[model samples]
Target: MDPLDSSISLGAASEAAAAKEDVESPDALLPWARFSAWLECVCVVTFDLELGQAIELVYPLDAKLTEKEKTSICYLAFPDSYSGCLGDTQFSFRLRHSVGRGNRGTWYEDGDLYNRDAPVPLQKEQSHLYGYVYFRQVKDGSVKRGYFQKSLVLVSRLPFPQLFRALLQVVAPEYFEKQEPCLEAVCNEIDQWPAPAPGQVLTLPVMGVVIQVRIPSSDDKPGDSPVTPSPKENLLPAPIILPSPHEQDLFQCFQSMLIHVQMLWELMLLGEPIVVMAPSPTMCSETVLALVSSISPLKYCCDFRPYFTIHDSEFKEYTTRTQAPPNVILGVTNPFFIKTFQFWPHIIRLGDVKMAGDLPKQVKVKKLAKLKSLDTKPGIYTAYKTFLHKDKMLIKRLLKGIQKKRPCEVQSALLRRHLLELTQSFIIPLERYLASLMPLQRSISPWKTPPQIRPFSQEEFISTLEHAGPQLTSVLKGDWLGLYRRFFRSHNFDGWYRLRLREMTHKVESLHLEVTCDADLLAWTIEKSEVEIVDLILKLREKLLRARKQQLGVGEQLLERLERSIHTVINSLPNDLQALLHRH
Candidate 1:
């Protein structure tokens, strides 16, 4: 079998088994029952004078990791900083490992092995785990270095940075005071917390802090909630609440480049390769995270590294100019990346956050030479032309808010909501067109093969855009249809189509099963001739075989019942006819 086919077969089998289990035990569908725990492992990384950064401790002791994995974690935990600044810093990075391996050389929590082959359908299977690190540097007289610097890293598949940071804030300090036992207590606490289920408001208590967050779902609407709630409402002794997992302030990070917000959104939606250069890891990582979340409800399908370094395994692959840059967003703090990623199409250089009353520098689109000459100045260097014209009204409103001395958080919320609505408007048309492609229930026939979804035609989809395309706002003026035409050629569109196709196929299969289960087998067999009854039996048997071969989640109990019904019908017939049928 082809490798891709093999993978699909395996995935279908897994889904089928899971569906069967879910049917057997309804509780299996619950969020808490599906996942193991929020926290995977607690890693303590310290800077050594001779060996550079090294892993001082990994809680649970037996948490499996390769040598290269350990090195990568240590480097990522500690920022690429030369100065001995004493404070706390929080950032995140992707922890990648091969898929085929058991739990032997990879990070595993609660004896559960990483079963997911890959997030995207790639040739090589790898697991991408998110690692949230909280680093602290404090003056210490005991150590000869005078400063005790270490990072307490939380490794998990969950991408809730704010929640993880809060947990670290409470746990890291206590860990420094009391070593191994503190991590043990924290792990126990995390294991007790409920799973991070999307579309639900979860109240998670870790150590002393209680975190309340709502994981965004694809089904969320733009107008569901206000951009920002009143301060009075938030002061009711509430836990650290975030509306979404990607809670980084967009207005604050891109304050200088607010005018080009529409252009940035376009780049993200198209899956363009962009690089973000910032002064600190915290800023770089947060900005990257914010960019990826710009089109909320629609997940960014491309690979993104929030905090990438020279030591990362993919360093050579990313930096090499032998081939075109892969569709990815890389965040880096090092000055060296400016020269290395010069060939990349889009680059956003950011300055340090300024104090109130300080004039915010406006972003200028500059050439590579100008960017190199004025290294300190923030700017966007890109040659990519945006499809849609700039939304000047949105920019004017944001600028007006700034002029009126509105809070930064409020301004950020405004931008976030605008982006969300913009994405929804763009997606709504495509969704409508795809919905039209699904085979209708009335078209299905019992004796016929299952109907396949209509093939997606670019021209057919585009024809409806004039009437159905984005109409949420009238602020922007340009060829909206043209923008969509270009979008159809993008990786984002491909990923979205594949996902929708799978979902539609599953729905069709479920409908087929429902129809089969509701069939009046005994009555139909009674009316039919012996040869016709035999043919019907053969058809049913063929469907069962096909379902098993396809690895569909067709319930075993349903199959058994269908089999019993066929036998009952056969036995109800004349004995000679039954014998003839059995012989055939």
Candidate 2:
């Protein structure tokens, strides 16, 4: 059978199965519901000598974009070194935008209304749009610049670097050859993709290529399950591929700095401002992504610019020496940044990938002056001290594995698993402590408003470290209390705490409504005075009004039942009391 035909057949089968599932289960998300969920739009960015980077085209014509957004997309898509570059380059960057504006309607206006997991509108709305750009520079005598420079960009909310890269591999070449019509066909193919339902194995056919992947679930843990088939097992032509943090080779990028892995992890956790200096945009972006994702499952709350250049809007804001550098990680190829970001506390300089040999270069810590020197070595330059001690045994094991000629994949897996475990070990204690802080579900009263979550206290959390902490289960140990103390001052802790608190508050609110709906109103009112009964009725009415106003997913039947229950209690009261309540 022709490969394209096979892919088409597979897609049809999957769609039929999905439709059947939707019929059987009314809650199933519709196809293309999250089409914009992963990919929002495809943009073509070109570099003009006078205009710099300019937006050549944006697919789907109706993709709402602001002037500022277009400018950002242009610059990000075409890297700083585009003028001097000769070949192809691929990299990713995060584009910040106002949440409710710019391509948001593409997702929300569709069947996305049926998506229960849609993000709730935020008061101060800001969001990051990840851009995966494939840039190319080819010889062209027709143009005055002597070379043609343009970039094909994939704008998405998802951070699936590998998936997007694969997509670009198909879309970019054809689009460059056939232009806008090629993009139109690609978009049509993409429209056929199923909703990105987590934990399900999806065989997505994009541009005649059948790619299979298992979207990681919220509960998925690193090293807990095998995402790929084992070597001994038969490999399918379209095997289910596990998503990666980024498309870059993490092991290769960080091989030189293997010894400083723990310190780097600590710095990332604390949201310290660090700069990565590499030989190219590819290396810079890859290293930065790898560092940020070191603490897997714990989302890095701080901002990171994978390939930051002097032309970026925020360049001045970040480089202002009058104030301390903000908590962000920047990756750059130009050596000029070394002088500009000299005030930055931590900087990691990576060696040229081409010059790398079988043995990885040993990393060393250097002073500011040494870093500034033209002949300075590639290593970590930082004044930051880690609260936790290094895991000598783990490092020895990894080094031994490398010496024993282990596969690069195996070594990378071992490192990633270790980092994940380390992060989980640190987070588990906080999670347990936070769980204890929740007001007991039974304590939620129907007569009164839900209780607020207890404020997080650093001292209180620390006191429990003796009985319940990472030390209890973690193989790596040191001054955990001290680490937690410092962590309380970091942005990661603040972000994590706020998110957890909001979720808990929502949970409590949901529980309160359920209790109110199922409350034994008549029985409770039996011993209550007229004043008390009236107050309870008023509270219940307020809750109902609030639920409706907020669209809290409360069913009409549930609200009506509660209303009937309230009326029943009121009718049972004395005539004069009832009349008084009615008038009020």
Candidate 3:
């Protein structure tokens, strides 16, 4: 069992709450007896933006600057950033509380963990994660204005009494008995709140308002008085199988990133390797995993922990084998690996801040002077930083070509021909790419015998491409019922459901395109092909059509389920809320 399992377990609260309810209110049943009812109260919002937009949202600009300054600022500020932009604003926010520790467990002691010799790194501290968003005004320009915001603040670590009160406000059953009154009282009490001082005895009148409501006798039902259950209760919360709106948005963004990866992969086949740079390792891992998991058939296996493990021998010609998978490689920005694989194609540097052009270089002298004043070895680091800048420039050049407008005119026949050409040309060379990645040099070595690269022909490629349709179809035909059960069993939050649905959507769409195009391609190819090839294409086309229909049907069903779930939550709100809803 995982060590953090108890703390994070979805089952713990439900078990305790169920027991308490069985003893206290055996007759009353919640009108909507599901975990999602409670979860709907928590709001989650996310935004995505470009670097300039992010700077604009936070930075106080004197005037519109040249494009060069904007580029320089983006590169400078790229090192510490998160993935979300609200309009022209970039920010990350998450409200985390303890489920494992029962909403009051402090993960760390106040003073025990603090050290004078070595201060705790803010990133490592689970207690909080907050950062200021400010514009880089120019070289050596001081930040004109800045404000801090909390994104990953720990709520469970509040003082015990205050923590208990806050938890009761959200999770206590008694509080829900008179929700409108409680909400109004809470507002009035907050309005009258004074600034905290030493030995402050703050009290919330909302708690008193809730206490005034009569506790329903065992004879009453849930409708007479709405009782808020512990949010932790019930490992499986919602009856819905589809993702929430916010989750859907995030998933769509992820799919867009995957398409970029696919484009890069296609280009890599043409020997135009590119670099993908992100702000953090977590982002990098998430990107790779999301892409791989979307297509992987082994997604259902819970024990499977898929990750790329790059061996030292990957760069060494000391063996005639490869340890890692051929399709994808994960790389984090580190000195040793970066230097070794500097010449290797398709390098992805996570937490990479380097940018292309002389703008960054132009500011390097000013940067070096500051480092020197701070008693750092500026001379040693300058050359390394310059190399990074150059490498980033190479990446920038490659991406510029790829960002060009693609062929947008869509024709059923033309699209089919294009796919057929790709299968015939690109798929045929997949084996050579895999073979070249093996720990063997193309040139003969004097000391050791080099293993012969296995032969892979166009016949094999065509065969694989032909067989891939059915494999893809099978994968696309996902077990929605099984997924629903699995989701409930795992007790994961709504975010997990959102991501799963998003991936499912991506899988279905990719498969739909692949099969539809291939079927079309077969029609075009059959004119010049033999009877056997024509027969196979016809069979494959039928399978593809059926698969697409099934996927569409399932998608519709899932969407219906999601719509119903949202409506149920909205309808369950109190009379006052319903009036407010109508007013809005």
Please write out the lDDT profile of model 3 over residues 61-91, one tens digit for every residue: 1222234333322232222233332222222
TM-score of each: 0.80, 0.83, 0.23
Candidate RMSDs in order: 9.7, 5.6, 26.0
What is candidate 1's CA lDDT for residue 252?
79
| Pairs clashing within candidate 2 | none
Give the winner by lDDT: 1 or 3.
1
Q: Alpha carbon lDDT of residue 538, candidate 3?
A: 41
Candidate 2, position 198, lDDT: 55
Candidate 2 per-residue lDDT, tens place, 37-71, comes to 55777889997889878898887677767777787
Query: lDDT for model 2, on a 0 to 1 scale?
Result: 0.75
Candidate 1: clashing pairs of residues: none
Q: Which candidate wins on lDDT?
A: 2
Q: What is the lDDT of residue 385 in candidate 1?
A: 72
Better of 1 and 3 by TM-score: 1
The order by descending lDDT is 2, 1, 3
* TM-score, cand. 1: 0.80
